[model samples]
Target chain A: MSGATSRATTARDAHRTAHVVGRVLGVGVSLGVLVIVVGLVLMLLRHPGYTTGQVPLHALIGRHARFPVGIEGLVRALRHGSAAGVVLLGVVVILASPIVGAIVAAGGFLAARDLRIGVIALVVVLILLVATVAL
Target chain B: MPITPLLFILVLVLVAAVAGLLGSLVGLGGGVIVVPVLTLVFHVDIRLAVGASLVTVIATSATGASRLLRRDLVHLRLALFLAVATTLGAITGALVSRHVPTRVLFVLFAAVLGYSAVAMLRRRPEAAPRAGHSDAVANALGLNASAPVGEGGQVVHFEVRRSILGLVAMYGAGVVSALLGIGSGALNVPTMDVLMGVPLKVASATSSFMIGLTAAASAAIYLSRGQIDPLIAAPIAIGVLGGATLGARLLTSVNAVVVQRLFIVVLAVVAIEMLQKGFA
Candidate 1:
């Protein structure tokens, strides 16, 4: 990668790898989506009724699924490969992406000696954690 | 007539795909379309629909970010700074959502949608200010960015004007995202374009980057409340992810102005219907 391939040394070059943020975000969500795909396929096979059966809109989605929360929830879900567990695991993965992304960005900024943005990134991470854990 | 689970998933997939496509074309998250369709057409509770839409929003964002983040289109400093405010707003929004009267919420959301429709119809603005020389705040935070335009990259010299207002608007955007389950691009893009003076593509890209993070912050609240239906969210996520990937690829080739106008028309109709529903 020639320096001249890009012009300004803006936020893009703040990290050693411009694409690290992409890979981090992409991998996290894609992995989650993949689990959902498998879980859906399994769901259809296990209960063929889902293919053609219908329920009232409220009855179908009004009640949230019985999924675990926080670290214990994640651990319990991962330990079991049941269809429900797999689906919950997918949800867990999606929920963790931003927290993970902030960590990556903060680390990158710190590595590049840009403390201002690094601290800002750290604050976002902390805020997300508080929201996730408290709310 | 009642809908079956199989039929429901198929319908959701179809709607989410269309939403994703249009959203990517216009640089918004597909949730703006998804939430209304799910609530009005499917007769789902607004909260449940919002929960489902949030998942699709994250999926749509993540798929696009995999490409855009590397293209140098995303302004990370801007996105993260905004996220600080937005995430706090999201948490509060989720907490207060059930308390907000549904009718009032509808009226408020409709107003936001109406405003966005008008903004979308306006002509595109000029490129961002000359690059290289950054203001004190901008340089200190590494907000100055560049995008690859024409042959070489163009340094987008942008000074974030109205810093407090921008943060406040982002907070409102986050609140709306959590409350209505829309991506809230209706506010973010405009705030960046009109207030901050970032280039259009850069603003859109940054907004797109922030969507996942914003949704993630809010999704946890919904999850803890037992509002997210995995069965409903999973298929929609799959479809939106697919559609957004296609839409992102078509972005450069398509005439964005035409698409923007068409989307505004559709949004206007939805807003009207939602207002009536609120009154009813």
Candidate 2:
């Protein structure tokens, strides 16, 4: 292939990968949102305070009363089928979406033989992981 | 402040959705609107509101950029390159926010925003080179890319120009975001689209992509601090995600000129509001 044709081919391949990555991101975020919605519905049903005009500032305190802390706590909550737990799980999933996208992009770049961007993607993943862990 | 529990939750979600829609349209994280609604209208604690707003911002970026990516409008390479400068700026801004006269900075930011609005409204050619080095630099970096134009199968290929300027603008955007607690999309879109010569659609998409990564940094801090309540963050995030998806789809159908006009309007409104608050 001529140089221009080769470049075009790479761009085309990159575009397809971009679409797939986009769909992956969308599905991950949508699932997170869906889980949260389910958790909210369950909370409404289980908590009498919601219907009773109580649980004032409910988001600020009432939910915090039984809040899950850290990644491990979120996993434990999801296992128990607790509403707040499920909601926390949603939050965790949503937070992880970009990190997952970055990692996938890194892999995709490597597969494409695009070393510079692949290295950059790996650096991005590292930054994200460090940020997540440091906090 | 004394509203019923269910009613408050419903209102919160609704308002967050509105914010997300408007934010995505203007390339913001929607926190600009969500923060005030939570703090002033709902009378939530400022810290709590900020935490919830940050999470909502992340949700807005994730959904908005995802759709843009699928549409092939996001310049992923450009976004990743700029992220380095933006992150550095964020750290610097956070360190200086407490010591600086933010009211003065607000005036300066509003001025920059006004200038961007003018640049956007002038209807200038978007692909023009900014300097002699622009084309050479872009070529060397392989920053040339393409996007699907309208309903046509044909594409418009363009190269990134004046990225030093874009990087500087991104750094400013990041600083403003960290300092003022507003999403930097207002600045990012114009910087990329107008200064760096990225197409408006691509610029907005890339801005959304950048916002996701930048917000994730502080968002982690806020969550780890136990500042975010699951109930508040969860519902606001759901609404933001939904609204941003709608906005992203709308973006594909809308003309580039119309999106630019709307972006200008958003910046003007945000600028005026910031100025008013600063003076008050």
Candidate 3:
């Protein structure tokens, strides 16, 4: 009876964790995609000739290419109200979603007192943060 | 064809949607398709292509894993445990990528993929969960999980075996991903399903969940380097998120045999692609 109870409890905790993680993922993606679409529409509206020019794949990737990069650049562009800045914000959100999800999972596991898995989750989160910042 | 920016974006979104759907189905991150299409068809630089592909991988992973988690297909504990190895390996691979010869790495990865394809083909699918099958390491780590296999919410409990081996394989997969600028989901699924005795469905879903973390590690570097062009990445992300969401929904209803067959085909194609890159 104790075994069965413990198993049931574990399953319940897993279910709750899954539920919370799923919501986080869904919301993150939806919000990011919406922002990107809005930015794209704004870009097209602002530059009516954007559709008229040929795709500048080569120019866009050239050494002289100028675009926002990193957090500082992203903030500057947003301040300038540039469409690309809005889109970059969306991309940033999309990129951050999984990391956020991992953090939430770690908290959930720790709260549930699954010390082994919780510690593992925390370790993973640390690796990810270090990789993101350092590498 | 006059490839205007609007037309290019439309085509990319369409192609990325297909890549996202297939990738989510097999947990491959869709980088293979996205990279090729961007570089070959759109004439985008390889660096930019890789950046866009990383975004696609993250998008597909997030959307697909989210749905899979809701269905209890993802083994969250197992994924978290293995991610430590993979993330560290990815960082190491990135650091060593410039020193290694690309051709040799490509050929070696192709061979590994070929062997994986053959091994997966020969292995029989698990019909039902094994009763009383337990592993000390997995039990201690709480890696064993249950999945809803069929109609009427029937759940099948599965055990994880040889978790240490799985972690090592994931580390290798991460290295390959960073070196080749691919998701290495081919390696991940096989490691979990073939080597670690994880059910194929669970393996694929968990792999999907895991790949995002691996891709994010590289994506941050790419973003800082200005490799990710907003115009290119935005559409790919949007399209992949939509397609992956659909693919995750389909996976729950699809037959395991069908998914396996499709994965084998994907592995074979990836191997051929790597071989071409290797010998070119």
* Number of the top TM-score candidate: 1
Q: What is the lDDT of residue B82 in candidate 2?
A: 80
Report the C-alpha lDDT of model 2 over B1-280, residue by residue, as the tens digit.
Answer: 4766667678878877777776666555667666556644665544556557666766667776787787777877777778767765655554455466746655655665676577557645434323333455456446776666424535666667787877788887877665545567777887887678776767777888777777665555556656567877887887776777677678777676676677678778867865664576
TM-score (all chains, Cα) for each model: 0.88, 0.80, 0.84
Could you give candidate 1's per-residue lDDT for residues A1-135 as a string of tens digits? 112212234333553444788888889888998888887777677766656564334454655435544455656766875565567668768767767877898887777666777788899999888878876
Per-model CA lDDT versus the true structure? 0.75, 0.68, 0.75
Per-residue lDDT for B1-280 in model 3, tens only?
Answer: 5566677678778887887777666545667667656754665765677677777777777877888888778888888888988887777776675566756766765776687678667766545543445467787876666677634657766677878888888998888776656777778987887677776777888888888888777777778778789888998887776767677678888776787688678778867886787788
Q: Of the candidates numbered 1 and 3, which has the greater DockQ value?
A: 3
Q: Taking the candidates in order, what DockQ does each have?
A: 0.44, 0.39, 0.53
List where candidate 3 sits over 4 angstroms from the true fold.
A1-9, A62-64, B22-28, B98-126, B129-136, B150-153, B246-278
Q: How many steric overlaps are in each model, in order?
A: 6, 0, 0
Cα distance off (Å), candidate 1, residue B40: 0.4
Interface RMSD, in order shown:
4.0, 3.9, 3.5
Docking class of 1: acceptable
Off by over 4 Å in 2: A1-9, A58-66, A72-82, B24-29, B88-140, B149-154, B179-181, B246-280
TM-score of 3: 0.84
Question: What stretches of model 1 exceed 4 Å from their correct place?
Answer: A1-17, A52-59, A63-82, B125-136, B149-153, B252-258
